[model samples]
Target: MKKVLITGGAGFIGSNLALKLIEKGYEVTILDNMSKQIHGEDYTKSNLYRNIEGKVKFILGSVENKEDWRKALKNIEIVVHLAAETGTGQSMYEINKYIDVNIKGTSELLDILTNEIHSIKKIVVASSRAIYGEGEYICPNHGLVYPEEREDKYMSCGDFSVKCPICDVTVKLKATTEETKKHPSSVYGFTKQAQEEMCMIVGKSLNLPVVAFRYQNVYGPGQSLKNPYTGILSIFSTRIKNNNNINIFEDGQESRDFIYIDDVVEATILGIEKNEANYQTFNVGTGVAITVQEVAEILKEKYNSNVKIEISGNYRLGDIRHNYADLTKIKKLLGFQPKINFNTGISRFVKWVETQNIENDNYEKSIEEMRQKGLYK
Candidate 1:
């Protein structure tokens, strides 16, 4: 069996990928610290573990530690590096932590792989769409495009503006491609860009095969609803299940290319199989943008309940206006396509959430109780 080491294997995407690899006859070993707030209480009993129980080897450790990575590298043929601080808004408040984990942690992993893990042939990295900050540019055939661009346009200003055909109107925000520029607006995005750069530099210098996947909004079951810092789908699903009011930050017009977790895992596996994916970056998304309002409506319809949605005028810092991915490259390169549609995925997720009794007691108290019960072991 092929030995694969997946860091952050207890998290959402990592765990899903691990289970898939195991099913494909790969020996999967997961190295995760399980430090997220929601996972702190029942980290071991998390939905991830429950789903992939007894199928893979689990190691309790952090990617920030070099020794942990060195030990995990034994007999490993491929390394799937998915461990990182992923909160976009929270990253602004904890810049050091993001850098330490996302950037520095990646650097350490690369160092160990090049120096010690000579048996490892390929490394797959998880990147994000936040790298492309708010900017507008002209694309061939697509006309002018503006999704996360800055608010103040040169033409919008009174003077020092040139009037052009593509300059006046906002173009249809097509899915972003692999060729998209790296102009991250938040510290999280910056760190992801740095991580991709590190992978490129190390792969070129050491002659190692590295693939970086720029993930869009990934959501499905096994997400931690208790952690508001990650997974908007989980947060909203939990709130809707509990009959709590859903909070909308903006006018609900800001859209996102929400891809299912299964599709992300499929793309990842295909990336590892296709030699062309090495030393390259690809966008893993559905290539379909949906408004926040549409998501709320979908949930409401699925649950068959009237959930109140309150729109908050204030927007989070470093939050982009809109973002999506162009999956043309991955499709052409890997011959991969997403099988799960949004409605089907959401329905499956809602059914799974309904089974969890998070509203039986206060959220904090229940989490503490689970901790006392020793579910994290």
Candidate 2:
């Protein structure tokens, strides 16, 4: 059995992937710091690692620590680097934190591979669609264009669509291909772009097998309901559970390509096993775009909660108007396909959310931090 070390292996996605890898007859090891935001203040209290308890080797550590990487990488054949600070809004204020964990952590991993003698030759890291910024759009006159992130001028007036650069007309949001030029609009996005670039560049030079999955908005069970800066599904679920109204940001029409956790794991494992994935970047998404308003409505209907859904007209400064991935590359090369649609996936997710204890609603506090930094408008 091949030995696999998954950094950030205790979080929602990492934990899910670890279990599947173990079942597939691979020796599995998990390395996670269990950050207070994702795993809560007390490590004993977090149920994040409960599902994988006694199933795999667990190391309580951060990826930023070279000592931790050295310890975790022992005899490991494949490394899946999923650990990073994932908050777009929070990242605006916590600039150094993002750089340290996401950017520096990856660099440290590269240093280990280059400097040390290790069995590890393959690395799979989590990248994000946010690196595409507003992504690709098609204007009637201009054909296809990759627009910039929506400005406050248009967002202020509640016009929440990417317009053509030449004509200033509303352009249709198209499926963003892997070839789409990267134009990240946030500090978080910048770090992810840097992480992916560094990995690919270094991996090629060293003849290391590296796969970067540019993941869309991943949602499903085992997500951190306590973390406000998590995916929109978790944020809204926590708010609804507490009988608090959800303030839908920016017309609620701004969209994301929400993919389920299981599908994400499947795509990742396929990349790990396939040789064609060597030093390649693939976009992982359901390839189906869903609006924020639609997501809130589905959750409300399922929960049957009377908690008001307010279209607050509030917009975040570093946010994009719309984005969804073009999964053609993954499908063609890795023979991967998303198994769950948003409707079915969210239904399963809502069931899981109902079973768990309602986490404290820290939504406002997250907003305040961004607002102070002038990132939240």
Candidate 3:
């Protein structure tokens, strides 16, 4: 059995991936700090923590610590780095924390591998679609173009469409490929971009195989419902369950490519098992863009809730207007394709949410934090 070390292996994706790896007969070990934000205050008793507890070797430590990386890498043949501070809005105010954990922590792991002899054969780091920012858009006049961050002046007036950089006219949203120019709009995105580039650059120098998976908006069962900063699906469900009104940002037309958790897990597995994935970055998404309005409506219908779906003109500074992955590369190389469509995946997720203890809605608190920072308007 191949021994694999998964950093942040106790969280949603990490816990699920760890379970899958164990089922496939791989010896798994997890290193995680178990943040209260994701796991709640009684973290040891949380389902995410309990699910993997005693199932694998668990090390409670921070990836920011070199000693933690040193201890976790022992006898490991593969390393799946999933540890990082997420939430784009929070990252804007908590800039130092995001950079320290995402970029500096990743550099620490690479430093250890560069200096010390380890049994590691493969490394898989989680990148985000946020690195693509506004992504690619086609202009009638300018052809293909990457738009800059939308100005607050325009967004303040309810104009949310991304425009052509050259002509300043509205552009069409195109699937963002791995080759898309990365000009991240948020601090979280900037750190992820740095992390991916650094790993690829250092991996080539070390002659070591490294694979970066640029995961789209991943959602499904086992995701953190308590966290209000990320995962809109979870956030909406919690509010609906609490009989609170659902708030949709922008005009409710702003969209994202939501990929199911199982599909994301399968893609990561392919990246780990396939030699074609070596020294490359693959976008892990279903390639279907779903609007925020649609998501809110679906969740409300599925849950049989009477809560109002408010289309708030509220906008976040670093939020993207639209972005979806182009999966041609991963499909051709790894024979990987998403099996779970949005409808089916959302149904399964709602069922799972019904069975769990409904978490208290802290959505407003998180938004208030951003509002105080002047990031949320």
Candidate 4:
């Protein structure tokens, strides 16, 4: 049996993946700090943490700590580095925290692999769709183009459409392929890009198999409902459950490619088990774009809540206008396809959210943090 070590394994994707790996006869070890932002105050009592507490070898530690990596890597054959600080708005102000965890932590892992001896076979790092920033688009005149970050001057005036970098004309959003240009709009996205680059570079020099999965807006059961800095679905669900009005930002037209947790885990495992995935970066997503307003409406309908959905024209500095995966490469190479559509996935997610205790909605507090930083309007 292959022994696998998953950093941040107590969190949503990691926990779910850990359980699946264990069921498939793999020995799993978990290294996680269990951040209060994600797990709330009572982290040990949290379902995400408690779900696999006794089942796997659990270590309470942070990825930024070299000692933690050393301790967790012991006897591990496969390493899934999923630990990092994630929040587009918060990353702008909390610059040091994002770099230290995402960039520095990845460096430490690579440094260990380069210098230390171990039984490590492969490493799979969790990248993000945010790295693509505005992603790919088709300008009628210029063909395919990757636009620069949406300007605040235009966004503030209630014009949030992304323009072509070459022609400066309105471009149609195209499914962002693995070959798309990386122009991250946020510090968090920048860190993820750096992480992916460092791993690929080091993995090549060290003859290590590295697979970076650029996961889209991954959401399903066990997502952090209390964390206001990210996860729109969780935030909206919390607000609806509490009968609070749902606030939609940027005219609620900004879209994302949301992949279900099960699909994400299955895609990740394919990368782990397939040799074709070695030294490669693949976009793991459903290749379908769903708008923000649509998500809010669907959740409201599912929960049967009367909360008013308001399109506030509010815009964040580092937020992208739209991005969804191309998924052509992953499909061709790994024979992977998403089994859950948005509607089915949302239904399963809403059902899971209903079963859990509703958390206090701190969405506004996070918005205030971004507002104080002058990042949010």
Candidate 5:
């Protein structure tokens, strides 16, 4: 069987990807520190764990430690680096913590793989859309702009503009292509940008096959709903399931390109399978932007519960007004397309949450109290 090493394999996306690979008959090895509770319990007990529980090897350790990485990389044919301190607002306060895990950890992992692991040929590192801070303004004809708002909604000043709506303001909202100029807004984004640059420079210098994926909002089951700094869908779902009001920051108009977990896993596997994926950075998203209000409505309809929603006028600092991926390059290069729609995916998530008896528990209460205490502050 083809052996693959997946860092953060116990986390939401990593665990899902590991299961998908196992289903495809690949031998999987998971490396995780178990520092945080992923989903609800240890990664070993996550919803997807049953799929690969005994079949895969689990290494408990941190990526920042070369000894741990060395043990994890043995006989590894491919490495999928997904481990990172992935919080935007939280990173603002914990800058060094983010740097330790994302920058230093990734650097250490790469150094070991390049110098020590001889069998590993390709690596797929997780990058983020955050690298393109706010994005640039372009004319409706896809021409560059000089500080003015672009015409395309996808490329515009609006939260979710894709193309120019008017003839005169025919500029496209600056959609982030692989070549788009990077200006990360948060410390998390800056670290991710650094991660990509490191891969580019080191991979080129060492002649290693490296691919970086700039992911949009990834959500689904097997995510830590208890963590405010994690996936929004899981967080909202947990709150609503426990009969707590959902809080919406900055009105309900802020839009995001939310990709289902399954689609992301599929794209990741494709990135590893295709030779063209090497030395490239591709955006992985549905290329469809949906507002936060739309997501709440969808969840409401799916759960058949009249969950109360509280809209706070305050917005998180460094939060982008709008974010969606341009799929032109991903489609052209990897023949990748998001198959699941927002409503369909949300329905599935609702069904899963309904089965978990998450009402009035300590975890639920603590989250509610935290929100009440303004822990998000």
Candidate 6:
């Protein structure tokens, strides 16, 4: 069996991929810090590593620590870097934390790769769709345009449309192509873009195969129900389950390209197995865009909860209006297609969520933290 090292192996997507690789006859080793934001205060409480007990080697450490990387990369043939602080809004305030973990941590890993005599031949990384910023759009007068971030003045007036840069008219949001220019509106997105670029640059010099998967909003079973900063589906599910009011940010029309966890895992697996995905970046997401209101309604109907859904006119800094993926590259090259629709995926997600303890949501508190930092408006 081929030996693989997954950096954030105990994370939402990493944990799932670890299990899938194990099933496919690959020996896996994980190096994770198990950040409290995602895994809670107790690292031992994580279900991600617990399920794969004795089946894989688990190193409880951070990628920022060179010692941890050294220990984790022992005899590993493949590397999947997934350990990073992942909160767009929170990243705005916690600037140092995001940079240290995402950029510096990735730097340390590359340093290790550059100096160390490791058996690693292939590597894959987790990039975010946030890098695309406002993404692609089209105006009737103009042909095709990649929008700039919407102005707060327009947004404050409740005009949420992304306007054409040239025509200055409201443009229709289209699927973000991989070739789109990356002007990340968030610190988190900036760090991810840097990480991907660093990997590609260094990978070429070393002749190592690298795959950067620009993932959209990934949601499914085993997501962190406690983390209010990320994963809107889990946040809504937890709040609705506890009869708490669902606070929808911005206009309810703000949509995202959410991909099922299984599809993400499948794409990652393809990146690992296929040589065609080498030294290339592909966007991994459902091509379809679904509104935030639609997600709220789906969960409300599924749980049959009486909780009020509030579309607060509140907006957050470092947020995009609408962005979805154009999966043409990944589909044509890797033969990948998303099988689960939002309805089926959410149904499965809610079933798994119901089995867990609905923790006390510090939703307002999390928002308060951002508000104090001028991130939440």
In order of appearance, the predictions have TM-scores of: 0.87, 0.98, 0.99, 0.99, 0.86, 0.98
Candidate order by TM-score, highest to lowest?
Answer: 3, 4, 6, 2, 1, 5
- CA error at residue 266 for candidate 4, angstroms: 0.4
lDDT of 4 by residue, 1-377 (tens): 99999999999999999999999999999999999998989888889998998999999998889999999999999999999999998999999999999999989899999999988989999999999999989999999898999998898899999999987899999999888999999999999999999999998998899999999999998898888888989999999988899989988988999999999999999999999999999999998889999999999999988899999999899999998999899999999999999999999999999999989988888889889989999
What lDDT would candidate 5 get against the real structure?
Answer: 0.76
Q: Judged by lDDT relative to the true structure, which candidate is superior, 1 or 3?
A: 3
Tens digits of per-residue lDDT for model 2 on 1-377? 99999999999999999999988999999999989998888866778878888898999988889999999999999999999999988888889999999999999999989888999879998999989988888899989987887778988888877888788898987899999989999999999999999999988888998999999999999899989986999999999999999999988888889999999999999989999998889999988888999999999999999999999988888888888889889999999999998889999999999899988999999998888878777
Model 6 spans with C-alpha error above 4 angstroms:
none
Local distance difference test, per candidate? 0.77, 0.91, 0.94, 0.93, 0.76, 0.91
Quote the positional error of residue 95 for candidate 6 in Å.
0.3
lDDT: which is higher, 4 or 5? 4
Model 4 deviation from the true structure expressed as Cα RMSD, one decimal place = 0.8
Candidate 3 CA-lDDT value: 0.94
- Expressed as tens digits, the lDDT of each residue in 1-377 for candidate 6 is 99999998898998899999999999999888888878888867767657666777989898889998899988999999998889888899889999999999999989989997989899899999999999888889987888888888888888878889897899987888889999999999999999999999999999999999999999999998888889999889879977899988888999999999999999999999999999999999999999999999989989989899999888997899998999999999999999999889999999998899878787788899998987777
lDDT (Cα, tens digit) per residue for candidate 1, span 168-261:
5444454567786677878899999999889989988888899999998898877777676667777777777778777775567778888989
| Per-residue lDDT of model 3, residues 95-120, tens digit only | 99999999999999999989998998
Predict model 6's lDDT versus the native.
0.91
**Cα lDDT, model 1, residue 348:** 87
Which 10 successive residues of model 4 have the least lDDT summed? 221-230
Q: Return the TM-score for candidate 3, rounded to 2 decimals.
A: 0.99
Mind sharing the TM-score for model 5? 0.86
lDDT of model 1 at residue 20? 87
